[model samples]
Target: MPAAKSDSPGRVRRIARLIFRVCLFGGLAAIATLVVAVLVTMASLPSFADMMQKPNGQTVRVHASDGSLLLSLGPSYGDWLPYDRIPAEMRNAIVAVEDRRFYSHPGVDPIGVARMFYVAKRLHDEGRRLQGGSTITQQIARNIFLSSKYSYGRKIREAILALAMERKFSKAQILELYLNRVYFGGGAYGIDAASRKFFGHPGDKLNLAEAAIIAGLVKAPSHYSPSADAQAARDRASVVLDVMVDAGTLTPAQAKGVNLDSVTFAPEPKQNSVRYFTDWALSQLDTIVDEQAAPLDVWTTLDKRMQDAADASIRQNTPKDLQGALVSMENDGAVRAMVGGTDYVTSIYNRATQAQRQPGSAFKLFVYLSALEAGVKPGDPVVDEPITIDNWSPRNSSRRFLGPIDVRTAFAFSINTVAAKIGQQVGFDSVADMAHRFGITTQINTHPSMVLGTSDVRLIELTRAFAAISANGNAVTPYGILKVSTTDGTVIYQREAVQPRVLVAPFVAAEMTDLLQTAVNVGTARAAQIGRPVAGKTGTTSSNKDGWFLGFSSGLTTGVWMGRDDAKPIPGLQGGRNPAQAFSAFMRVALQTRPAEKFATDPTLPEWQLEPDDEAYFGNPDQGFGGDGAPAPEAQDEVTGEVPDVQPAPGDVPPPADTPAAPPRAETPAEPQLDQRWLDNVLRDQKRPPQSPPRGN
Candidate 1:
């Protein structure tokens, strides 16, 4: 049968050649299409040729008013480092883990592309995230221009731009750009910032392990940042070390010998050390300086020494659960120091400037001042006996009430009954008006209890009021950021202190100062004495929910408040306790460097005398309750359950400070029947001395 005649060798060769030609043609067509696509993508990409020669972007460096670094805001980049300054270890570690064939590849590694697809398929089947397969150049392209969203178009553009980059710059130049631009966690935009943020050092100082850790972060900055999670960073570094060894950039023995245990992380980023002040200043920045107007120098009015002292005092003295706030102002209303809370990091709530807590008895200043405005003298008789106004009854901090006390003694001891009676006599509207005139901006409810300090006020407003009192009734508007200028020395904003306005007669404030001095000298705020003459009042809510001390020397006014954010009572807390102590502690340090000063006093006034009846107000300090006074009322407010310990709640009174037996309910003094002529003068901001030679005496 011709032995199944096999085809001739020539015929077989011809058929094999035809089949090979067809396959080759198909491959050539595919290559040509890809090249054309690459060209089109390259046409749209920007020039990377001279990018390294030009500045990337500028950062907004923030400085304290004193010219010290505070924190930096953004242009989304950090200091650019030359390639040589960046440690070799840092660059090598990056190359090892990110792209081993980086130097040899024209731009993109086809081998890497294959492995990426293999891993992607496996991960997709397992329902895991598809990992990035970008080479270093491709990553640079994406970071510089293209979007990160996964799509064929992005990948194509990224690859074409990477090829373009390869042609435009050397390997070192590309790596330099990469290190200077890639984000490395924190608010860091590049290696320099990342290094400083995590290690508290610069890029040139990075050790092998540090470099490896940084290299590891290229994959996921936030998740593996040493600042956020040291363990995660360390583990990732180990992986990077292994990759380095496999890439021949590091030896296995060397990698094994590296210790990650000694690595220390920087404190949490933006852990806002001075958040309250920073926030306030930053807000002002918007109005005064254009955020985009280059860098600026903001000179704040803050005294660093005072701020530190206040922060420490609040932290060390207040109970952990109990929050505290403080604001210290110069007599001219300059905020020298402020502490918004125990921790600004855990919470950014600025209690000193933002919180509107009841001033407690601290608020009695307005009531007493109002009475003074109505022609009531500091020595005028003020009955502290049991008094009921409508449905409200007020008592002293100590439950026992002294029968009849002078207005000065009543204010010094923060007698709630006397203050409430005074508020009633002068009219609640008048008292509220006085507070508004002094600096309070929060709404004031004109209920009878208002005199007991049930009205809400910000710590800053109340502190400024004390400043006004110290300045002899001249109202001061508190201010920070004294001046702001451009980095190049162009003054953009300058704060000019306005001449203080007269809120009350200078002599009236002076007399009030003499009366309040008694508080720190022998009454409730005794804890606040700074060994210098201080005029201030103590305030505690009936529920012990808020405690406060507002005081001032002739030069500085300081106020402190301690309470729970939720307004819950802190058992045993009082105005004379932590709040007063903190104020004193802060003042002791704040005033240590300054000349000791005292509040101006009007000695010719009867304010210095203590009546025997008022002496019974606080029974002998040794023996608790002494006088036969009304029993202390309940700590809870009858009008509202929100009893701030600022003043004695209706039922809450001073314990047996010596007092006479419950005196008959005194008739509310008819608005002092002042001589119409004298009254008209007082209402006109008269500064007459409190001890004037008699109108009728």
Candidate 2:
């Protein structure tokens, strides 16, 4: 009976052993099937993220304010330094923090996994979650192939894939890939941009302190951001410096030399002072560079010196509460400087290239150019007397007839009546065509009012038109960029705005320039006259709001505009006052360094004999004045010989015309009325009274 019982026990033990064996085999089979299923799923899935294309090792363009290039973009591993160019210290920092036993273990670290599991279990008991042990290869796999879903199943797959990746790549290869893929924030995807952002220097040029700060950012970019948290970032950098020292990546003294405080994590990016030019240049990026490589380098014809001068002049000379713009371009249409507005930070309305305002008397240049083409000579007389055409009787600024003035004098003084008559005789279409040929891209209406510069034209187009005069009638459109290169210095595109010549004749342009110079010398634009010879026109719209000064020298052409953005009239401010002042200030500095040169003249342009008859253009007015009765002569005090209020001349009544009436006759206001209501409103809103009236009263 004892033998049988013992046999039964043995049988029972054998059965239990068999059951255990079957269960273990089934578990193995299930695990193999699951592994195959995960592999199939991963294989079938699309890429986790689009791979960033690296042209010449990746890049982003950095352009100067005037569209000139400061430099090109390169990789974090020492720009163009290749994977092998990585410093041993950086390599060590990455390896030590990411994977201490990277060389000794396969892609999946079993010891690390065991330790992580113990930690995770402890944390779970405390109702917390912790990171799983992810090896460098595991992270690479996840970055390249898997979604960052942070799931248990994903973790398992990551471990398996990591092991698989280890079989395919060497430790060094994996390390390099990991270093390049890490995000360091502030638009810096890799160490290169980070190095630049933090140290104002390149990654390869980084000292031990800068390197430590950058290395520390990988742990928690925001937490160690130098700009946002300088102290924390410095502390973190100190820890990195100590680690690097212990790793012998840096000497003790070298680490000590690295002042963590000296490492600025967020260095101020170089600002583009020439905001208008930079904005215009960026607008041309699509045409200048390949759409696929727009983030590359762009080289332009922008002259920094000229840009600085233009900007300073615009800001310093523009009146308070007024918008201003200045643009400077080379004779060939390469924009050297541009001031879009007084302050680009406060407002980005690029008045130089975008804002379109009436050209005012500046438009008379086109009218005069047309009349010249129509056989009218510069010295030909044009009557500045009252003239009417279809009920539009334009008057001069002085509102008094200037009989038999020469065309040169008429244009220089911006005589409205003479310019209108010339427009009538030459035909508005002819003048419009001349403007078009001069690179006026904006539409121009063919109306008599167009003669007085009624068309809306941006400063960019105006400057380009003036460029024709500087180029001896050869028109060249202004552009921002000259060449674009890939991140690795591969020239992708080049631009030079030298198109086929579009002008009547170089000599015609030279002659026109000669007449314009007279305007600056002793005419309406006298304020713009520099010691050096300059040519330009002053313009004031009928509303006295928009004022303009378009001028140029042999090497450059510039346009200045002053006006309120709201188009509100500015009393006492005229083109010659503010616009010309700003233009003169800018040109003085801009042309200081430019060689004193002169535009070439061609004496063979369509020759026409000078006609000195002013009556031909002015003719006669059909009717007499239609306003209040003529005033009497000035009254004199017999006792003290004091002059009394003067009266208008007999039959000198104001004429009815489409042109805005001459501003109200100057008068001394009463003390109570002397305070401007508009100014009072401004001061009242600020809880301040208007400053005491100036002593001028």
Candidate 3:
């Protein structure tokens, strides 16, 4: 029965022929349609010439604050360089590692693609991730234009786009764009940035070992970064070098010349000395000029060497608990150096210009200046005795009666009672006016306490104020930039000298200088003396909240302040200690090269007493003083630190017999014999009232 059912050979042959003919016709039609579809798609795309004509985005070069080149900051997209800049070894390494037959076909290599497909299939079978077979150009296309929304449709689109790109752009162009745009990790967007970020210089400057290491970084930047994994980076570099040798991109002899182990990297240079000054000048310029995009190159008066020395000095001298700021300028108002803080890294807030704090005894300079302007000689007998003005009976910082102290002693020791007396006599308004005229721009109260630095003042303002004394009493506005030049050497900005007279005659200025020198050599500011001729003043505010050391020499004038950011005091830390130490250390290094010169003093300058201003001593509005008529000490003649020879009875110095005695001890425990005038003004309001004795006693 099965033999009878068997089909004839002719029918089997006809069926087979029919099946073959139908399959062939269908395949031909499908092929024709696919070709037409591809042609239409190509026709719709931009012409090759038009695609090539697109402009790359702008490239902006970033420079250091001092105009030194740090890097070129290019846009994250679109910008590219020529492939000629790329090393041949790098190109070969990429081809050998990624697509072996990259140049053998058009944009999409069919055989390589097929081989990739087979590998991917194998990997999938083995439960592994799909390996890539993209040519460099194809990768560039995928990375630039396509989102990683994985799908068969996306893959087809990417292939078509890659083909379009290859047709439009040269291989060199495509490769350059790809290399520039590829992510190299560590926040580096391109090979150039990667070169800088990893090796601390430009890409073109790299050695062979560095080049190999960077070439290896393309595989997995973080994994091969020398900073992240030194051994891994070395291993990857070795492999990359081996690949170069195998591809014949590098000869064996040349490969031998390249030492992967010899590649060394340098630490990024920190240009901080000029940074603060540059920032200051920029800030000033921004405020002065309306246009921010003016592309200005400011020429500041910042002495780079001096600034570095000042910073170094502050670091060396300041205690762990202290932070310091220094500003120095010539009598002509050319700022030589400035230290904004001990570590600008720790706090960018500039203590020289940005911080506002009480001045303490340093404020007494204004009072004395005002007093001298008011025709009161330094020898004027302003009683040191505690006197009552309003309801306040102010005493010295020691809270005891000091007998027969002079004005010079009051200022040298920073006697609070005498400083108040002088401020009252000269009129607090006059002191405030002097402070303002001397370039102190902060708001100040016209109270007796203001004479003691109760008002807030920034270090810059005080620096300028002190500069007046340095300039023979001519107030000088501290300026930084001398001129700003464009890249092409066009002068875009220039600084102008503005000098305003704020004090009396140059004789008075000379007299003040002598007294200040005495202050340093034999008084409260003795700690500020250097081996060379130097002058400065030490000021400690109430509760040790703010420690101030302001001084100036011929070479540099710097002021340091030490305290907590908030008004709280650090334990066992004072301006005289840490701030003074920093100033001394900094000045020592700064003035090393400069010839030592004595401070200018005139013998023609009239001699003045160092007596405390009796009215100032008794008349502080913050503390009401009753006219109890305490016995006051007479103003003593100016003397060095040595004890006076003609010492009268302590009770009968010079003031009225009924005048009260001034404090016998110094305000600060560290200096028991110094005066305490300016400090009393700061603490008068905060000072505790005299305690009443027990009734039983």
Candidate 4:
């Protein structure tokens, strides 16, 4: 027994020695691995000078024609402020919230690290994850040199880089770099940009409360942005103030007197509608300039005054449940004002440029333009009786038609039967071709009812078509960007000043203008007249699903559209009732500073006169038409039909190689001759005023 006990003691001694050697070797291997990781991280580090000098990323700042800032496209930055220029309160607040021992610690704070470890152990035991414990310098290292991905190796690298940075730069220089590089939310980088974005002032002017608010944002930007939630931001600022008191940067009494309630943020823009314009302009940037790494300044053709006017008109005129869009442009297609919807915040879908809705009678401009181009005169007589083609019957809005009326009178009244008859007289293909020639890019379904504007179209494209008419038959391409340049005034792209392509003959445009003028003066669009030589057409789709007014005056063309997004009918809605009035209201303000100009008049053509019955229905030439009567409604504009194949079948389409072809059928006229009595009445009506004609409802 004594010998066994002696052996047991020796075995215990050997086991202890083995454990000690194994632990020592393991510790050395771990140390060696850590050292190698540090060395690798150092070698891969980005140049310190380059990191400090470079911006976060390329930004595109959009501005209005008058040089007012509209919005920024990418990461927004301001000029870097030096240490001396930064407010003392801002520096103090940042230090108190981010790192109390910012001045005393070498970049890796020992106390903070120990606390972080203890917290991490506790969290692990409770089934939670560890939170970050980076000091100001460590944050600078991570932001400038390393990715935000967290791992043991990343932390070791962060510490090593921070320590190196502290050794190279002074405390003031390090702080200045951190302030200028950190993201401050709201797409703003750096204190200067954040200050201007939230408070509308520079960083040098930050008060204690404002400084605290800005300082509190480093931890959670979107959650506590003042622009997002003022009360939450103020509560966070109060926490920052408390930290400042604890850090001895401010006395308790001084902190107590600071009123977060008195802190007022800058007013947000009246509406986010400008974002729609900016989004459109940004899309064209790639086509205009080559892909660039530096920031750019895009000067656009937005007129703030006209944009505000259009917004107000839509807001005040449109019903609450319905939506409205307005687009205004110069005669050359430079878009000056555009409101995509009633509120862009609720819906970013730009109705003015994106949504395609049927433009009712307003589309008749193309049909009439085609007829005039085919040698149909404005004073020519047309029958407005009920008609049917391909089992499809179309009637006038009034349900009763003026049997025999001149082309100008029928157009002014927006008579549906007359437009359809004209479409047949001039082939429907010609009408669709006319629309394309005038700048409408949407597909046109050319049915008999197409003359009444059945196919869908975007509001902006329709406005561009009208701009062509206003430009005296010249084609217009809608554009917003005027010039693009660098921040230092180096021009990257300037719009080339080229002559516009001619799309229509001047004589045809003149006759179309005459028809449009008659519509505004004594027909469906009477509400759109602005006490000047203005011309426009009113459009109302079936069940009042869509209403439109496309008009021009004072060298500007504006198109207004009102409808429900779901294509549901709005009770009692008509093109002349709300759409025309909105157009007039917007144009009145848009042209307040400009003089009214007259459309080109054809001196050789005979004077346009209304039929005897039409003169009585209009009541007075000075008061215009539809005084107390309801504005004309549109007939059912569309009907479902199978589209015929324009091309023949591929198989068995041609005769056999040896077969003889059949003879062609006898020719038939595409249109019947107009009644001579109607033409005789039209010529006689222009010579004298009517004596007594029946009044119309």
Best by lDDT: 4
- lDDT of every model, 2 decimals: 0.73, 0.65, 0.61, 0.78
- Is candidate 2 or 3 superior in TM-score? 2
Q: What's the number of clashes in each of the models? A: 32, 1, 37, 0
Residues 66-180 of candidate 4: C-alpha lDDT, one tens digit per residue: 9999877778778789899999999999999998999999888999999999999999999998877999999998887778888989898889888777766778988998998
Cα error of candidate 1 at position 428, Å: 2.4
Model 4 compared with the native: what TM-score?
Answer: 0.75
Pitting candidate 3 against candidate 4, the one with the higher TM-score is 4
How close is every model to the real structure, measured as TM-score? 0.73, 0.61, 0.59, 0.75
Lowest lDDT block of 10, candidate 4: 665-674
Full candidate order by lDDT, most accurate first: 4, 1, 2, 3
Can you give the lDDT of residue 381 in candidate 1? Answer: 64
- Residues 242-287 of candidate 3 have per-residue lDDT tens digits of 7777876777788778777677755544545445555675567655
Off by over 4 Å in 1: 1-66, 70-81, 99-101, 104-135, 138-163, 200-202, 245-254, 262-273, 319-321, 345-348, 499-502, 596-697
lDDT by residue for model 1 (1-697), tens:
4543555666788999998898899889877876776676667655555554333334555555467766666544556788899998999999999889999998899999899889988998999967688889888888777767888787877888888778767899889989988877766767887888788887789999999999999899889988778999999999999999899989989999999988887776545436687677667777766656366667777777778778877876677678889999888877888889988878889999899888888888888888887888776665667888988887654455555446665666667787788889999999999999988999999999988888889999999988898888888888877777777888888877586579988768877787777666556675565555677887777677898888987488999998999998767677766677677667767776666554456322233333344223222222222112221222221222332343332322221222212233222111222245534543442233334312211
